[model samples]
Target: MEQAFAQNLMQAAQAVEQQVDDELNRLEKLTESDIEKMRNQRLETMKQEHKKRQEWLANEKLTESDIEKMRNQRLETMKQEHKKRQEWLANGHGEYEDLPSEKELFDITKKSERIVCHFYRESTMRCKIVDKHLEALARKHIEAKFVKLSVDRAPFITERLNIKTLPTIALLIDNIVKDKIIGFTDLGNHDDFSTDVLEWRLGVGGVIDYKGDLSSPPDNNERKKKITVFGKKPKTIRNGMGGDDDDDDNDAED
Candidate 1:
């Protein structure tokens, strides 16, 4: 009876030990699964953090203050250029620098302190008479500038100024059209005309301050007066002839 009891006790002990080993194996598998899950969660969190950092870097750029500063710089540069242009104009560059082209004419008439423009046609005979007077007046009146604008060359300026006559004189003061003199209609119909008559007429129009005698006789060039040099050789006109052929010129004059 004792031997049978001892064998049965041994078998019971072995079965208990097997049960303990099986329980241990089950706990080990559960612990390993929990560790793997925790590792995957940590890796996903790291990926999200990396993505957020990259987004923050990408959004970095010029701030509002930087953009505003750039705008201010541009405005300052424009102001400086404007000041320089005004200074250039103030230095009397507009007084002497005549308009070189049709494009410059408008700017000159609008910007110059005082401007006198003679609009004339090339083939017109009256244009020469106007040019002669303008040349002499320009030399005498240094306060005003004289400019010649060809009517044929500048059709746009002619139309813009509303010039109808072949020889038109337009005066501008402070870049504004003050007055205009058209044709020789003011000089009267007499064939013999004087520059004093022209000058005085312009004076009447407030163009010049010349108080010279208006009724005085005109010069020889203006009146084309015949100077009777009795029995004398005529002086040679050095106009590209380069020859002092007094005999031929005297005979021609006779």
Candidate 2:
């Protein structure tokens, strides 16, 4: 009877140990779940804080006085820079050394058969527009070359071209004058003049109004007609020699 009682006690101990292990596993799982929840809550709180900070920054206002002060500061900075540049240029500083010379400009103009030279004054709207269009025009017509000469930068070219306008566009073929247009109007009008200049240079006669693809070769007949130089034709040898001298002599002998 005492042995059987000891056996029962061993069974009870085993059952207690199993219950303890099960409870420990459940507690650990609960602890991990709580930690995960806390981490997510912390992340959400940080996101909310960031959003609030961005909103506050967006709502922040700058008064007229603040804006005026900022503008004044910028203007002062610009003035100082302008003064420094002027001083550097006046003192023959090497910073402004690589500017294009008159001789270089002349050489470039002479080398190009179909050359488009632009003369423009400094800080002008027409000048800016011309500057922008020059490269595009050059690319569109590879046969033509585009060059920019500033009235302020190259005074000699400006004087030589006799540029009285703010933006002067000169088209030359073989160093000979083809056509010239001055000033920049509205986009519509400016495009008209640009088209006119290009068409004339390409020997397209009058302005080509059609906006079809320019990559295709122009009409052969139209090209011939436009390029043909109008002048008196040379007299034929037969006409000049009075209808073949040998035939005339044989007829006279007969």
Candidate 3:
């Protein structure tokens, strides 16, 4: 399934590139007057679209037939959204991928415009928790690439990117690191933080393109409570894991 998705995106990208090349070749042959005419045509098209939108929303003066037509348009819009989502899935945007090789990370960053990489250690409990939320986010936000890299396997990248902490979510755009979220500090200091908390954090970093409100906290009432007896008391946690020195050392060894 993933192979098929990737192939579809490659085909689409190639088609777009061909179109761009053709347009550039045509532009080279066109005069300045031709460019101005094309610009005027684009402006007129935008004006028509804007007028249609106004009519779609103007309920006061709309006749029954107009309302019925608008309702059908709304249904068509919903279908279009579904089709767009399918296209997104086909473009390899709907799953949290655990990259097989560290080299593949570089490939993903180059091909994908926006990427969220969770640099995690296998033994760390917090990293596992982060994986759960990230998996959910990958399905929800189909606008960015979500992936994970094992700190042990990706030694060169881990050192170069300065990913010293467990569960470090590195946000990258155009292969350049834009932001990093180390530990659960930004997320309320707890093991059971909701998916939206992580989603909101990613949204803040511009990794995910979303329009939903991120201001409100997830209504996890037990955020202040400890999940297990071994877990630390609910308090502010810094870079280090909330567990003992042995646990921190274990994560560092990765």
Q: CA lDDT, every prediction?
A: 0.60, 0.51, 0.74
Predicted structure with the largest TM-score when compared to the true one: 3
Candidates in descending lDDT order: 3, 1, 2
Task: Output the TM-score of candidate 1.
Answer: 0.43
**Which regions of candidate 2 fall more than 4 Å away from where they truly are?**
1-99, 185-254
Once model 3 is optimally superposed onto the true structure by TM-score, how far is the C-alpha of residue 92 displaced, in angstroms? Answer: 2.0
Question: What are the per-residue Cα lDDT tens digits for candidate 2 across 4-23?
Answer: 99999999999999999998
Off by over 4 Å in 1: 1-100, 190-192, 212-254
In model 1, the Cα lDDT at residue 167 comes to 72
Locate the minimum summed-lDDT window of 10 residues in model 2.
245-254
Error of 2 at 76 (Å): 65
- The clash number for model 1 is 0
**How does each model score on TM-score?**
0.43, 0.36, 0.54
**lDDT tens digits, residue span 152-173, model 1:** 6777766556567657676665
Error of 2 at 150 (Å): 0.7
Highest lDDT model number:
3
